[model samples]
Target: MASFKKTATGWRADVFKKGIRRSKTFRAKREAVAWSNQIEYEIEQGHHDTGAAPPNATMYHILERYRDDVSPKKRGARWEVTRLNQMMRDPLLADVKLSDVGPRHFSAWRDKRLKEVSGSTVNREFNLLTHACKLAWREWQWLKEHPMAGVSRPPENKPRDRVITDAEIESYVETSGFSFKTPPATVLSRVGAMFLFASETAMRGGEICKMKKTDIDFNKRVVYIPETKTGVPRWVPLSTKAIKILNHVLDYTKGTPTVFCVTASQRDALSRKIMKKAGLEGINFHDTRRTALTRLSQKFGPMELAKISGHQDLKILQSVYYAPDPSDLVEKLE
Candidate 1:
């Protein structure tokens, strides 16, 4: 038999068979009735899988699950893993119940962290926590509710990300070509090739470093990014400039399987040196990713830009990569 009943908390439906019971909660009477009907039909179909969905799972466990099971499958696995490790170390989350965390905890954490970190950084933590709770609520049934439901992220904090502008790029080419650091005239070319290659490719620093002999296909004009943010492999086409750099690198490592090996810090130092030499102002290594998306979005829709960058959604791309909202109407009024 199927039955619907009202309780103080809300409404629920129960299905009974031989002293056994199955029930689900609802916020409305109509919903209760509909769910009751659905349960009865499911029973008739010989599928009864409802049980006491556990809600006492610790926050740490859910985060670990996401890191191990969910993150490694992403192209951003390296960065995601680092973020998860940092979250796991947070004192609030260390020995607490996932179910017990509420909006207060989330709000307090975000507010406090904002003082110490950039808003974009705070947003990353907030997003990470939200996803952890979502996995617990939806996939694991480990939480009665996701506490991050109403938690808002901090606004972006954009200090000039050090980027070598078009002017600087030309200066780098000029100085390296004629100056003392010029190419071996026997070995590969000198300076800016790696940086320019990276800028034009939009390939992440790590991706560029980890590239292999077999990854590039000159005729196809595509490089198979076998590992990506989604853990799903994807392909990114290379610009002619990017190809020229890769070919240059290949000449030096003719027998080696690894592409160019460069650390994030090393690249940063080189970029800073080049920026100083060219007398350019502001631009960061990661800004290349931004520059790529912004230019691409001009030609392709946000969706197409997202495809190249492996962003899960356009909103994220727009928030970070899109130019600031224009105010032409306000200007006209002024």
Candidate 2:
């Protein structure tokens, strides 16, 4: 006989006959009922293979397949590969077989991981595993259910609200880490321009650093980003200050095709020097993007802001980047 019941997370289907018992859970009630009916029919007709998976196949195998086949197609393939490597180091998780893995296994792993890393890191790794399990179940038919669907994920911290100030920017650009000795004029100039460009364009440091002359339209005062983090191409309008910075770079590096000719390490080293000189605490290059987006939100609507920022989702822009000033509300009340 076969029966179905609803659980807190989903519907559970159980089949019991001839001293053999089998059970599985589904997120949908109809799926559970259908599974139960199929199993009951199979049992009555004298042919039910018990849905057993190959014994040697394990989570490690599935993750390896995903890494080799799926990760390269993603924009964040390096990150996905890193996560897979991290998971492979866990012996217990690596040895877990497709048929034996259940919600309890994931629950225990989640509890153990939370003690070692930040909740956000664990959340990201969990998402990767969830996708792997979903692919196995839907595409490979290696699993009857997704174990992660019933597991609890760790809570993540809210987006940072730190916005860089103009005075701090000026201090960073001039006499940054040069109290005892003079810094390289060319390097400091490039670093200062990079900071100004990020603040004015709301473009990421990597995007700005890799920019070439062909990506810009001087007549239109716009820079076309061919590849962005979201895998979308966007044309970012240049501010007057941004144009001046580019013009200065052209005068300095006359033959270089790249707007910023410095390497990432060079950029980071200069950023550290500026931070030390400015005596600024808890500010980073990314904060410049937050500050630019917050200021721009006041002048542009969501659609225009999305176009300028290359944001696929406005909710992310509203919640994470747009830091509304409380002083504006106070002024209105006054």
Top candidate on TM-score is 2
Q: All candidates' lDDT scores?
A: 0.66, 0.78
* CA lDDT for candidate 1: 0.66
> What's the residue-level lDDT of 218 in candidate 1?
91
> Candidate 2's residue-wise lDDT over 1-334, tens digit each?
8788886557767777755455655789899889778767766776644433323567776776677679999867867987886786587687788768888888888889988988998998888999999988987777888877868888996778888888877777664422213322376668777887888889988788789988889999999999898988999999888897787776666677677687666788888877877788899988889889877877788999989888898889888887868996577588
Give candidate 2 regions above 4 Å deviation. Answer: 1-55, 174-192, 251-257, 262-278, 328-334
* Candidate 1 lDDT tens digits, 1-334: 8777786557757666544455654689898888777667766665654432223446666676677668997766777878876776676764477647788777877888888889988887777778878877887676888788877778888644343457766675554342223332321123355556666766676676667879888999888888775666777878877787777666666676566555555655666676677666666556777766555555677676777777787777776655532463355468
Q: After superposition, how far is residue 175 of candidate 1 from its true place, in Å?
A: 9.8
RMSD of each: 14.5, 13.4
